[model samples]
Target: MKTAEYEIVRDFAAQREQVYAAWTRPERFARWFGPRMFTTPADRVVLDVRPGGAWQATLVGEEGFEVTLRGVYREIAGPGRLVFTTGDPDSPGDGPASVATLTLEECEGGTTMRFHQFGVNTDAEHAEQARAGWLEFFDRLAEHLAVQATSSKVSARP
Candidate 1:
């Protein structure tokens, strides 16, 4: 049997453009794209951030194990939405790919991000792991945005 699609909605206290940049920019993306316990080296990240472009990154765990994520952008709508196909780079052939759609909406105080990932087929254990990983990843992303917003505000002041 195939695993079900997963969707999550998160709100960030940052401008829509800022949140979008954090997701699309390689330098910023590598800082928070992995699970909470993993670290992504700056030199190991590559993000093209355009329709038909490719993005790749490697995450290193505390034990030095590496996980490579490779993806191709399917659609790009400025700072509002993005769709991509992603999978494990080390898998045989092209690996099991999933389509991810992320939509960002500007709200009263910030941005609301709706994320949906489909076409995932794995064992129950792996599906649960993936869900947990995404939750942790988003948690890290929120933290990164908070720090960026604070620093930006400080720098903007005289």
Candidate 2:
């Protein structure tokens, strides 16, 4: 069976640890895990966040549809890199699960994140949609990080 893949490179105005925490911390992840019109509640997100550990998240759409994604962590190098396999448990026999890798590099001002996902069980068009969805998710992440930064600054005022 044919498969599709995509890679996205983005730079965030936050430290590598801050960006990495957004993915590993369940509370932070819940704030930006899904696309627009979808919410992933904190209680529904589980992140074991270690090699061989399992993680799962359920995003509920505005219209009440739910998408539950489950995965196992293949590698976890905190604040640097992460590798995992993700798939929808509801869809059995769709194809092989996709493997996703997130690499974070600390630059002069912030962090550069390289995200890649492969082995998607779909055509190019669907793969494009998936890529778009991930972009949306990242946009939300940026917004969340900005808010966190602002809050941290305000709290630091003495």
Candidate 3:
């Protein structure tokens, strides 16, 4: 079967550790895990953040539909890189599993994130849609990080 893939690169005005935590920490991940029209409750997100550990998140859409994504950690290099496989939890081996890789590098001002997902069991059109969805999710992440940065600064003021 022909597989689809997508790559996205983003730069955030936050430290690499902070950006990595946004992906590894469940509380922070839930805040920005889904598309703009969907919300992932913190209770619905689980991130073990260890190789062989499992992670999952269910996003509830505005129209009342739910989408759940579950995967297992394949590799984790804290504050640097992460690799995981995404597939249906209930039904394994039904199709090719998608692998997602995220690499974070310290840049002059902040962190540069490179994200790539491949091995999707779908066509190009659907893959493009998935890319768009991720773009929306990243937009939310940018906002989340900005808010956290502001709050941290406010609390640090003496």
Among these predictions, the greatest lDDT belongs to 2
- Ranking of candidates on TM-score, top first: 2, 3, 1
lDDT of 1 by residue, 1-158 (tens): 35457788999999999999988888899899998778898799988888889889999997789999988888999799999877732342534557889999999999999998775555566656777888899899999999998999999999
Candidate 2, pairs of clashing residues? none
lDDT score, residue 21, model 3? 93
Stretches of candidate 3 exceeding 4 Å from the true structure? 88-96
- The list of candidate 2 runs beyond 4 A from truth reads 88-92
* Candidate 1 segments whose C-alpha is farther than 4 A from its true place: 1-3, 88-95
Q: For each candidate, what TM-score against the reference?
A: 0.89, 0.92, 0.92
Candidate 1 local distance difference test against the native? 0.84
Candidate 3 per-residue lDDT, tens place, 1-93, comes to 558988999999999999999999989999999887788999999998899999999999867899899899999998899999889423445
Displacement of residue 49 (Cα, Å) in model 3 is 0.9
In model 2, which range of ten residues has the least summed lDDT?
88-97
TM-score for candidate 3? 0.92
Model 2, span 1-158: residue lDDT tens: 55778899999989999999999999999999988898899999999999989999999986789989888899999889999888732252765467899999999888999999885566787778878989999999999989988998999999
lDDT of 1 at 87: 73
